[model samples]
Target: MGLLEYFRLAVRALKSNKMRTVLTMLGISIGVAVTILVVAIGEGATKSVADQVNGLGTNLLTVHQGPRQMKLTAATRNAPTQTQSTLTLDDAQMAATMFPDTIAAVAPQVRGNIQVRLNASNAQSTVLGTTPQYMIVNNVTMRSGRFFTMLEAQGNLKVCVIGNTTAGNLTGNPNADLTGQTISVNRDDYLIIGMLTPKGTGTGGPDPDDMVMMPVTTAMQRVLGAKYISDFSISCISPTMMVMAQQQVTALLRQRHHLMPPFPQNDDFVVNNQTDLLARSQNVTKTMTMLLTAVAVISLVVGGIGIMNVMLMSVKERTREIGIRKAIGARSRDILMQFLIEASIISVLGGIEGVILGVVSAVLLASFGGWNTIINPMALVLAVAASASVGIFFGIHPAQKAAAMNPIEALRYE
Candidate 1:
């Protein structure tokens, strides 16, 4: 018989047991749907990290305080003491001015969470106090008004810049023209001098567009009462000078802090090239995605096994029908093809249903759950192909068993 005839026979047989056929397809359907969802979430997270990294630029370097390990010796161990921040504003300025060839700009920062109020609206937000060069080093731009100037930073002005999310939290609009308005931070009203361009929620760290920016001097003296800056960002003159810049800055910081190294372990400050850090982060994300993909594959395998079990049961239950077909001059290959086609139809239909369900779920997650999901067309094609392959692979044993049955014995059996 032709392939279409075989399919028609398979469909009629499956229709005779509609409930069982539907149940048999359930495993494959769930498997494909889960695989699609996992891949969508994984890809979204990786893409988010990549975008954040690219936005930060390749030439940027970040310096932050590292853990201070007390020296231990064979004779005696040093007593544990409170670890203080090893970096200061002076270190940042020296790194920028002393190495003009390597370092282009420096943004020393001190950050803290503070309560902010605008009329009746109240919210808690991160406040970043940094030099005006934060714009250059971080590639930040103003949507309206302007960043604080060097004169304002030096004079410790009570002016601030707000990100879109921060503005929305207080003003009920993300794109509100909050520039020139005053918002109270810790009961101290600071004039909003600028509004930053919106940066959507990031996967890597704190939300970039959910914070306030002010002059470092003002943050240290008036807002946070911080003596030492938290961290600093430096932009190298060129990507080629990253290593040289890192070395020079490390040496400068070590010297300034009077840190006698048993090499890097004795150092209380950590300097990282942003690109390298980002690459490491991307690697981590890729690893997680790979792990999740493996789990999805395992689910597919389980579904395939379910298909095999159902096909086997169908072959046993239809033994008398198989005998009658063979007795009526049907070939063994015809019997095998009939069973195989049934299996294929079940899996193919299940896969299609799964794809629809997964795509809908991904859309819902992206829209209402605020999740990032990208439906890869290639993934859809591959998932269906994989399901079909699984059906054929699992169906083979049952089809062969049905084909090999002796017609006389099958007919005699109850």
Candidate 2:
């Protein structure tokens, strides 16, 4: 007659079929757990990307050779690889001098892979040819000694800076002071001027602190033996100036490369600011999260179907009881409510169990798999809400069937 009485009846019914109830609840629990885990992993990945970008500072922008490729086509893929870079060291110098107010610093780099040997220890490592401005533009910090001087970079001195991994391999110690030590890179001996502070892998990229850095001039002339610059790192005066700086640099490069309007698509350079990278990363992660969540929700739907099936069977078995209640003063709504409550109770309980399981799974993944996982409180709420909704949506048909049963027919049934 009352809500509490209906709930009691519902509980009694579920308790009567203990094994069935448990199995149905287990289904819901598994579904909810999977949804939570997938969402948390996606959120963690997105956050990791943001943090990595922030670590490089907000004002940073990178200029690379060639236009930004929006898509890969057969023609583009089959095109010959240009041995010459459209971006040159002079371009970096011009950018710095042209935007003295907007640009704070510019660091041109020449990149190559080489074998580095220090006495009996030898290891293959990436070699970066950069300028003194690299330390400022890229926010590089030294653990020991200091960054190479402007004079050293301009004079093409054979001084180098070692990353944490390089230091460890060369000296067998990560924290060892290797300043003033000699390490041969590609058969060319270079004096270690500084040891960089450790910077872990960021945003799925290689570890910053695992390379050997020297002057761009020295790398081009004596190391990589190339003339064209690889890329340039530009730091704006402030975060607000990043957009202006990017536009200025783009326009400048276009003019320098003779890329006029109607032929702008043929530009031979691309300028990417930090915000652009962050937006792209977020979009990718969002799509991935939605796809995974959809797959996980399918299991919840299956669990809901299981609840519906069990409820239908229960109604058939309790036909005599339903007929007797209808023979008395019981109303159709009361019967419907009773069965609906039973389904809700099962789903809610399963949802609670699912939350616990999901949290544990996320923690285990983060600990053992070395993954980043962050379980948002909203995810818990969403899982529980989804489970409850599933139960109601699926249970309605069975509840309506029980309420619509003919009393006379149900009463005479075996």
Candidate 3:
């Protein structure tokens, strides 16, 4: 039979059961839409994580004082939760000095949310207290100025570098350039010698842009007094020294923290390389995305089952029509093609509509819900393949049942 003829017959078959077709299509459509949205969102989040990790060079390691809380763990007899205390400036400097090929710079950080002001302009932001080595550790570049010298840190100068967000809020205009300006942070005068390049925020902390950076000694002595260090950033002397550097830092911190010989988990501090951290985060997201996609696939499969059952009922209901067509010149293959095409048509249409719905949904969520949602081409391909697979798998039994009917007996069927 001609392609048009097969399509015409398929349309008639579907039209005869309008309500059923519509309901089944709706079920399939929703499944496709959800699959597309979930995978796209997953891929987008992965991309963001990769970018942030790459921003921190491969030789970088982050030092956190607290026990990891985000990942699931096996229940222990008595797992001690960590309170931030393991990191200190002494430890940071020691780490930098211990390994020859592994340690170029280390920057200890202490943070607090405080109000910053410039004359009459004011905004609240997280204030970071770190050394001149912070620039080397973070590998961040100034937009149009310079960082403070080591001498300034030793003397505890009241100089600070500000991110774009902090500057905009303090100046009351984003475009107003801030350099060599005196800003009052917590009622103390601070010279803003540098403005940092815009580094967007991520899940790791509040937006990097919405922060104020200051010398570690000055912030500890003058701004936020009386504090143990919370964390530190370690820049390996080079890529080759990363593992040895991590080991040396870990061993020293444990000894200082008084962790006994047999209990490594009792060590409160964690030394993480940038790529390792990114992989951990991506693994979690990957599992969640797969689970969501699995649920959608199950729904799609269920919808296919509905289509198969309906088509089987259709064959039984139109036994006389099948017989008439077969007796007149239609072959078994023609009947099979008609039914197969109908099933495929349902999936093809549902898949197309689902792609539109999925992309629209992702864009809407990204804009309104403030999520890092994105659509990916690979996600589209996956949706199409899944939908088609469902159609082909479920349509077979019904098509076979229809093709097997005998013309003489079907003609006699009421």
| Candidate 1: stretches off by over 4 Å | 72-83, 115-123, 165-176, 182-189
| C-alpha lDDT values of all predictions | 0.89, 0.89, 0.81
lDDT of 1 by residue, 165-225 (tens): 9999998898898988899998899999999998776654688999899999999999999
Query: Global CA lDDT of candidate 2, please?
Result: 0.89
RMSD to the true structure for each prediction, in A, is: 2.7, 3.4, 4.5
Residue clash pairs of candidate 3: 130-216
Please give the lDDT score at residue 102 for candidate 2: 93
For model 1, how big is the CA root-mean-square deviation?
2.7
* lDDT at residue 349 of model 1 (Cα atoms): 90
| Model 3 regions more than 4 Å off | 1-4, 15-22, 67-84, 257-259, 363-378, 406-409, 412-414
Clashes of each: 0, 0, 1
Put down candidate 3 lDDT per residue, 85-154, tens digits, no spaces: 7577788778777775678888888888889888887799988988888888887788867777888877
